[model samples]
Target: MWHISEYDIDKAVIKLRHENADFRRRLKHEMLLPTDIENIICMASFGIIHLELQPQIIKCKKQ
Candidate 1:
C-alpha cells in the first residue's frame, strides 16, 4: 500500500498544472480548464488505478 503525503500531492498538483499550461498554450482557441474538483478526482483516480495494478501479496502463518 502506498502512503501518500501532503508533499507528494502538492508535487503531483504542480506537475499537472504545468502540463495543463502547456496544453493550453498549444491550443489556438481557449478552452475550459480543469477545475479544482476535477484535479482532485484525477488524483484519486490515479491512486486507485495504481493500487489496482499493483501486485497483491498474501502471507500465511504456519501453526
Candidate 2:
C-alpha cells in the first residue's frame, strides 16, 4: 500500500501554485493505485489529513 500526507498534498498544491517545474514533472511521471489515490482524495474532500500523508506524495501516474 502507498501512503500520502497532508504536508505532501500541501507541498504538491504549493508546487502547483508556483508552477514548480521539477515537482510538476515528478507528479506527472508516477501515478498511484486507485485505492491509495482514492484515500487521499477522500481525505482532502473531507478536509482531514491522514496519518500517512507525511510519508508519501500522491502518485501522478495512472491508476
Candidate 3:
C-alpha cells in the first residue's frame, strides 16, 4: 500500500526539487509570486507529484 505521511511529503518535495527540473522551475516561480497564483502552482505541483508516486489514487485524496 502507498502511504503519504508528512515525512514522505517532505522527502518527495526534496527529491523533486533536486531531480525534477520542471518542478524546480515551477517552485521558483511559485515562491516569487505574491498572490494566490503561488498557491495554485504549488497545489498543481503536489498533485502531479502525488500522481507520479501513487497513480492508483485517482483523486489523490489524503488518508
Candidate 4:
C-alpha cells in the first residue's frame, strides 16, 4: 500500500477535467481507485527528464 493524499487526487482530477471536460463529467463522484492513479503516475513518470526507474521494491519508512 502507498500513502496518497485526497488533495493530490483532487488536483489530478481537476487537471484531467481541464484537459477534457466532457470525459470528466461522465465520471461519477467517488474516491480515485488506486489502479487509476497508478496508471496516471506511470504516464507522468515518463514525462520527467533524466529520471531513472529501478525495478526493485523499497519499503517506506515514516519520518
Candidate 5:
C-alpha cells in the first residue's frame, strides 16, 4: 500500500484517460502490486489523500 497525493491522483487519471494501454503496460512492467492499484482508486474516489493516508488497508488477502 502507498499514500498517494492529490496531485498524483490527477496525473494518474489524466494518464489513464489519455493512455490507458500505456498505463497498464507500465504498471505491469513497473511491478506494481494489487494494493498499489487499490490505493490509487481510493485516492481518486475520495478526492483527497490526506483524509485517509493509510496504505494496504484495502488490499485483498492472498489465497
Candidate 6:
C-alpha cells in the first residue's frame, strides 16, 4: 500500500513513524522507536509482513 507516492521514501518514513505509534506499543508515553520503525518500513518495502496467529496455531503430528 505504501510502495506508491512516486516511491517517496522520506515521506513514507515520517508518516509511518509519526503516524503509527500505537501499533508498536500501548503505553501513553511509549512510541515506536526510530530504528524499529525504520526497520519495519524497510521490510514493508520488500512486501514482507510478519505475524503470528496464536489461536490458529496447530502442532503437526509426527509420523
Predicted candidate 6 versus true structure: per-residue lDDT over 1-63, tens digit per residue: 434343554555555657767632422344434454445555546545443333332332445
lDDT of each: 0.47, 0.51, 0.46, 0.47, 0.55, 0.46
Per-residue lDDT over 1-63 for candidate 1, one digit per residue giving the tens place of the 0 to 100 score:
555567766666566667776534523233323443245335745655332222332232345
Name the TM-score of candidate 4: 0.40
Candidate 6 is scored at a TM of: 0.28
User: Over 4 Å off in model 4, which ranges?
Assistant: 28-63
Better of 5 and 6 by TM-score: 5
lDDT of 5 by residue, 1-63 (tens): 656567877776566646666556546456444555654666575644434334532333445
How many angstroms is residue 19 displaced in model 6 relative to the true structure, after the best TM-score fit? Answer: 22
Q: Backbone clash tally for model 6?
A: 0
lDDT tens digits by residue: candidate 4, 6-52: 66556656666677554354344443344445534544444332324
The deviation in Å at residue 32 for candidate 3 is 13
In terms of lDDT, model 2 sits at: 0.51
User: On residues 2-63, what C-alpha lDDT tens digit does candidate 3 reach at each position?
Assistant: 34466655665667678867666756555322322333334445554322222221222234
**Who wins the lDDT comparison?**
5
TM-scores for candidates 1 onward, in order = 0.34, 0.30, 0.40, 0.40, 0.31, 0.28
Better of 1 and 3 by lDDT: 1
Worst 10 residues of 4 by lDDT: 43-52
CA RMSD, predictions in order: 16.1, 8.8, 11.2, 9.9, 8.8, 12.4
Error of 6 at 9 (Å): 14
Candidate 6 structure lDDT: 0.46
